[model samples]
Target: MEKKIITISRQFGSGGHEVGMKLAQKLGVKFYDKELVDMLAKDGKYNADFIEANEEKCSPPMCPVMPGFSMPVFYQDLPSDLIYKGQSKLIRTLAERGPCVVVGRCADYILRNMNPVNCFVYGSLEARVNRKMSMIPEGLSFTREEIKKRVIDVDKKRAKYHEFYTDKRWGRMEDYDLCVNTDKVGIEGAVETIAAYVEHCK
Candidate 1:
């Protein structure tokens, strides 16, 4: 049997990560998300904080965060470019190893040659805001307005990162094999739908 890979690109507060995790579990495959960042940090001998901060983010032309000052000496070079290259390499390496569900980091584009099932998950603003609010800690105070702003900001950053790296429009339906609106079908339904597709593909 041929290996199958699922790459998910999600909007903030879209519950895409939850769906991806559930799908991977149901499919009995490995899942990659923040785990990829940790792996890169450990393998590259980079500060985890530095990798997290710059991962999926394009570098400013002016080098806003100077190494040995704002950043560690290990990150003195072109850190953003290195981060992109490192993660891209890791994504391809993992895909070659076996089947896995990779969330974001342009995994869809990175594994394009592998004919992976690329999914884009998005939700209505109202649904996204509610989802974000529900995830906040009980004692934490976050208004709906604040959550909405956060969602927009995060989506914008993701779009910019995708465009910068792949030159493809983020969340665009044409770029994906499946485009799901979690607001309509809910997370569990979305997972079931994608899982069925995966099974059929096999």
Candidate 2:
């Protein structure tokens, strides 16, 4: 059987990363997440920290976070288009390398032609907040209202960033092979369900 690529687009605190990790382990394939930033940094000579800080988020005014800091202008400067171009290029490179489970980074649209198993993971506000609370460090504490607000803000930014980079609508069922509600089914259940779906796809 041909190796399959799995692209998981997930909401904040939805356990998408955990699910993706489990899926990769179950299938014995590599997983790509923040590792993508390191790969991009090596290929593009861009700073890894810079990429991580801005990964999957749009600049508010469409301005570079650090003025005048970017990859060397390849030819004519496509200033406005540079980050999107670089990010898309990086995503393409990773997908081409092997069968991997990619979390976020818009892998769905980036590898659209690769016959990837695309998934979207989301949950209700209360579920998401509870998950976030569990993941928080011991000393740091936040009210339920604060956690809920943070989740909304992060997901909003992700949606905006995805929309800005791709023509296809994000979170639409048509764009994905499977849409799992983490609230309805917990993380491990979501992972097992996806594993079964992947086997069927094969």
Go through the candidates in order and give each one's C-alpha lDDT: 0.87, 0.82
How far does residue 54 in candidate 1 sit from its true spot (Å)?
A: 1.1
Error of 2 at 165 (Å): 1.0
TM per candidate: 0.89, 0.85
- Compared with the true structure, model 1 gives a TM-score of 0.89
TM-score of 2: 0.85
Candidate 1: list runs displaced more than 4 Å: 1-3, 63-78
For model 2, give the RMSD to the true fold. Answer: 5.2
lDDT of 2 by residue, 1-202 (tens): 4469999999999999999998899888999887777877777656887777777877645323455956433334233245556777877777788898999877888898888999999898889899998888989979888999999999998898888788877788888899999888898899989888888895
Give me the candidate number with maximum lDDT. Answer: 1
Candidate 1 on 20-138: residue-level lDDT in tens? 99988888889999898789988866778999888877776543555558654343346677888889999999999999999999999999999899999999989999999999997
Candidate 1: 10-residue stretch with minimal lDDT: 70-79
